[model samples]
Target: MNYFTRVLKYGIDYSYFGLLNILFNILYAIFSALAFVSFIPMLDVLFKQTEIVYTKPEYTGIGNIREYLESYFNYYLSNQLETDVSSTLIIVVGIVVFFFLMKNIFNYLALYNITFVKNGLLKNLRENLYSKVLNMPISYFLNKKKGDLMSRITADILEIQTSYLSILELMVREPLTILFTLIVMFTISPRLTLFVTLFIPISGFIISIIGKKLRKDSKEVQQQQSNFLSIIDETISGQKVIKSFLSESFFLDKFKSINSLLFKFSNKVINRKNLAGPFSEFMGILVIGVLLWFGGKMVLISETISGTTFIVFMGLAYNILTPAKNLSKSFYSIKKGNAAAERVFEIIEYNNDRVDQKRDVELIKFENKITFENIEFNYGDSKILDKISFTINKGESVALVGSSGSGKTTIANILNGFFNPKSGNLLIDNNNISQITKESLYKNISIVTQESILFNDSILNNIKIGNLDTKKEDVINAAKEANAHEFIEQQLDGYNTMIGDYGNKLSGGQKQRLTIARAMLKSPSILILDEATSSLDSKSEKKIQDAINKLMQGKTSLIIAHKFSTIKKCDKIILIDKGKIIAQGTHEELINSNSSYKNMNELQI
Candidate 1:
């Protein structure tokens, strides 16, 4: 469906609250019009033009209710005046005050009910947006900017709340207020009401022109804001590299350019939105000016309407201006909100081709072996893995050794079910891995990557994330096994020591050990180490390598190693070159038989 239709559908989902709002708003509008209409009799009293009446007014049909109301007021005023003229004036003033008070009370209730629907829709929209982002495939985010996604969730949703959700108030309350006011105006004088209606279309046509331009500019403003946010995110993430290269000016210039565009587009949208209020007011005054001339002539020359009724009609006409201005502004806001809704829905409705299909089988347990049968994988059009086949039997530690781009890491990714191969089957225990639910598949496996991914939390908390139910003793034991217990104990708070973002507070070796400690806590049946110790110094490497050995004991392991020293003692080594396996053997066997393996081993040495 179109974006506007989608926005209305979101409102329809919460129609219960909207309907309540409508009921209150209708009451508010009727009271509001009656409050202004109450002034008609007060005007008659002030002018000493109260009509003389001896008997109660007779009942009349709806068409003559205005005449009936006027006659009844005259009948009461005549009685009150005979006793005390001051008391008659007091009663008229009291009636006017009561109508005004009731009008405001109903107005407040309309706003109260509208607030619930507004906030409820916003809460649902944000939750759904975040859930969709979490469940989307990893590949879907390969090209997406973190800031763009963040903008969609945060700023874009806020825009929809202000522009779209607030439309409900304008749609129900404002239009009904105008309608009620016009009914009173028509009752007072239909000729004057007819004259006012003729000029409304003209004002609407002008407002529509401004709104058309506002929508186009509003979409650009939102897009530019997303771009600006992306730049800020990239700058913050790569601050180290930017500072090291002394390229701060370059990024500053880029930010300034995006910010400048945002400023210009925003100015256009605001200018257009602001114009609606003043322009509608001006058009309203023009109509009122014409009415004053024509209606005043009718009162004085033709004597078709009274002075007090004409004054009340004028009050109602001016009252219509406020809702008219609001209606015009609401139109502009809906246009802007429609743009934001499109961006939000784009992510919420994203088709993640990589999401696992429904699997009714019980949770998978890794038993025999993981086999890659003729695996062929491509990224875009570039072949990353081609017709490759291998197997790692249960409790065996096999290292995948290859050049930088020879598909070693791709094997780890596919095996971990992060991506599916273009043409292949990764079988776990003779059962297709694709048939296993991702949660079930991942429960039996753990991965430690080259970079340590840690949150800004305590050391104990980070480790506990692997298994929330793990005991303190078990966590300490896991840390001891990973060789991290020593350094952790040295910290002021020991296990409770706060690790900063990405574990930046710790040394590379300390961070790697903690990650190993985390994985050790998981104690999975299978483990994948993707150059887990590649960035560590020799001393740290030896410590982490010892931990790796301890963690790999009696577990099925896949090691993608760049350093020959790291995987030299594996049960077997599969040497890959340019997406295809060229050889598989022990280190000595490969050194004796394969030139490529010998050359890589020599280069590392």
Candidate 2:
């Protein structure tokens, strides 16, 4: 019930449709009761069992409603029966048919209007989850599974919609159907209605017991589904590795093992869920038998309610059974939906420790230099960087030469405001970078990392990602500067060619150059190249080197490189090892003085 209430919070925008549904449900409930009640008059007039009244009934107040209705129905029937009994019977049957028709029409209208509410909730909930995922920090997903998140957004949300849809009708239509029917039953015979009300609560209690464990059982199923989904996602992403390793049997066994568990879990949940309908029906039939035994004594022995009126009372009593059965079914559905709703809301409500710090002061421009003073950083208990400090002057191209895991990339991330140091400060142009807004900070910064990141779209669209406002001619110019223009023009559709997923259709060199083209198009004031050309062959590296030199002509640049040859021409080189700067000087100065830098340089040759 708690989960059910939380899911409804997103439905506030569709309250107008909810109101229409309620209004139509009220009409539906009224007609549903009247449709059954119509039999009372029809049976009397058709069978000629009821005595006729010579005079019309007088007006009465609400307290005597039952007596007044009976008097009025008999008065009208007597008048009509004075003519042909066949014609009167036909007229009575037509009235009953009309009542049933109106009952169906209003029921449909109630469901139709609520469709907007349910569908709107579905749209809003999915959108909210997607928006939350997009806004989450990169660190938040480090321990999370991509496929599990996908399942929460896709399959889990769908489950919430399917199971909880009955809740809308349960809230208004089902309860009111039962309420209006009970009123009709009481009017026909209060004693029989009294017995029904007592038995109803007992059945409802038993039904509640059956659904108690449903939520816990359903949560287990949902969790296992997310696990299998993660495995599938990981398998697809690592398909090349599996094939190259010839480990097909290993992955197959793993998938099959998880699938086997899922089959068991699904069967358990399905069997439990399936029991609700049959159990509820069985209980309803049992109650109907008890009601018949009790009511039959009142009609046959006591002779209080007329035979025709008792029959109508039984019809009204039976009407309660359908809604009561539906009510139990809806109860079980809500239980199932609770599990899915909890999973989806877990992501939506998750706390992101790395969310951008909101500050009133937004940095508007970059000037002078960037400085890191007494900076310290840690990844868990391990020290990633200790007392690190560096400075990059405006328009001065500096290079960081370090082995893998030497914290050079971490330094670049701090400089670009992707991370904050645990101690000390990072400043830009004498102002604290912490005080700077991330959006404004990123506006002046650009990165060309080792791996090329591209979307599944036209090459034109992918290139425009850096600056959407950049014109076609300027894009071509940028591509040419990055040495990507020649190959792009060779494609079937040139710039308009679809790159396929992650730009897989392009070669490694072409993809990397396209990233460089994107960074060039942005024309940011600061550029960080993290091992950008290290992964390419010598021929490709030379072309990219010329492009990088051109791209860094006047920008304040920081280059992290494993290849010593690439940083030889930089104005200054900082050599890092074990998360600390071991030496700093021009390339020639380092070769002449520092044996550590000299030995590392000679080994690369």
Candidate 3:
């Protein structure tokens, strides 16, 4: 109830719809009880020795029940026609019509209201989950599996909507049906009603014991499903790499191993769930058999309860067991759905970890200089950057170069405000960057990393992602400036050509050029280009360098270059080693005075 209540509170704002649904369900239960009670009158008509006579039932609210039904009974069979039109025939026809109408009407209302509830709940859940994802710190993603997160967003939420919430509806509706039918049974014979109440508790206790294993098995099955999805995602995203290495059999073996675990857990869940239905039904039938023998003896021996009343009570009592079966089944479904609900709530409840301080201020535009003062950063036990201090004046180009693990990319990440230093401070225009909004800082800084992130969209749309409002003419100009215009225009659709997934339709140099076009379109005040030309051929690098020179005309730039030729033109070069800045100077000064730089250059030459 607590989980459903919490989900409901966030699911819809108004409570009136839930109240309305309850009211209709009550109406449905009332009609359902009357449909069963009509069987008593039917038996009288069938077993009549003379014209069937009736008096109001001596029970609370029985007067009203009689008034609503007696007139229809009289008109249906006139006194003269008692030989042909017995009360049994009339009652049977009346019960069929009443239940048919109630069934159709209730089914419609139930479906209509649940549609609203399902879609509304899904909408709110998705909105909240996506918002939480956006607000979470970048570090949170590093620890999570991408496929698992994706599965939570897609499959887990859908499971809650379909399995859990749907079972909750049965939790209410079916119990009411069973309760109303039991009340009618009590009215006909208190002894038989007591007989029914006896077996329900025993059967429920047994069913609950069997249901205990459901949650554990369901959780294991869900985990196995997520593992299968992760392997599929990896295989699809890395298809080219797998093909190059010819590892299809390798991936298939891994998938099969996970699939086998899923199959084992699924069997456990199904067995536990399937046991509830048949075991409850068998127990109910056994109790019904005992009631028939005991009650038939009391009636035959001229007990207070008549034969007709006892038989009608038996029919109503049998009706109660149907809903009891439904209730047991719903309980099993709840246990299974709870596993998915736990996974969904786990994601929604995750801590964002990074919190904005009260003293934080919004940044506008950088004016003076960007400074990193004695900054230290570590990822777990390994220091990525240590005691790093540097200053970049307005409109200056700085290059950082070293071997693979030399803290070069870490510096770019820090400056772009992706990661805050573990100790020390980063100041932009003399104001501490930590005190400003990350989004605001990003507005002034543009980055072109080694991985070219292009969506499956038109070339025009991909470039327009830089500045959503940029004009088409401006995109063409930016593309030309990035030296991508010639290849772009040669396409069948020119700027409208579909790039495909990750720009798969294009070559590496073409993708890089498009990425550069995007950065140029952004035209930010500060730019960071990490290995912008390293992956390209010498001819492409020379052409892209011409584009880079034009882009850096009046903007401050941080260049992370592997090639000596690209590094030679920087206003200054900072040599980083083992997270520390061990050398800093122009290329010429470093080549002359620094042994490390001369040796690195000699190796490159």
Q: What tens-digit string does per-residue lDDT give for candidate 1 at 338-373?
A: 778889999988876434654434445787998999
lDDT against true structure, model 3? 0.80
Q: Which residue segments of model 3 deviate by more than 4 Å?
A: 13-17, 49-92, 243-250, 357-359
Clashing residue pairs, candidate 1?
none
- Assess every candidate by TM-score: 0.94, 0.94, 0.90
Clashes of 3: 3
RMSD of each: 2.3, 2.2, 3.2
User: What would the per-residue lDDT of candidate 3 be over residues 1-605, giving only the tens digit for each residue?
Assistant: 34555666665643455666677777677677777666655565566622243433333476577554564464444443445554547546677687758866985686566556656776887888888887777767877888788777777777677666776567767777778888877777777788889988998888777767887788887888788889989998999999999999999999999999989999999888888778878878987898889898888875867676777677777777778887888778777877877887787888754446532666677677888899999988999998999988888899998889988988898898777789999888878877777778877998887787899999999999889999999999999999999999999999999989999999888988898899899999999999988888888778888888888879999999888888787888999888899899999999999999899999889
By lDDT: ranked, best first: 1, 2, 3
The most accurate candidate by lDDT is 1
Window of ten residues with lowest summed lDDT in model 1: 353-362
Off by over 4 Å in 1: 1-17, 60-66, 353-355, 358-363, 492-494
How many clashes in each candidate? 0, 0, 3
> Residues 1-605, candidate 2, lDDT per residue (tens digit)?
89888888788899999999999999999999999888877887766776688787777789887778778877777887887778888888998999999999999999999999988988888899999998776556766888788889888998898899657777789899989889878767777888778867897788778787888888887888888899888888899999999999998898898888878877877787788778767876777887788878877998877788877877887788888878888888898889999999999998754335543356676779888898888877988888888888898889998788999999998887767788988889887877777778888999999999999999888888999998999999999999999999999999999999999999889999999999999999999999999889988999898899899988999999989888898888998888898888899999999998999999999
Q: After superposition, how far is residue 127 of candidate 1 from its true place, in Å?
A: 0.9
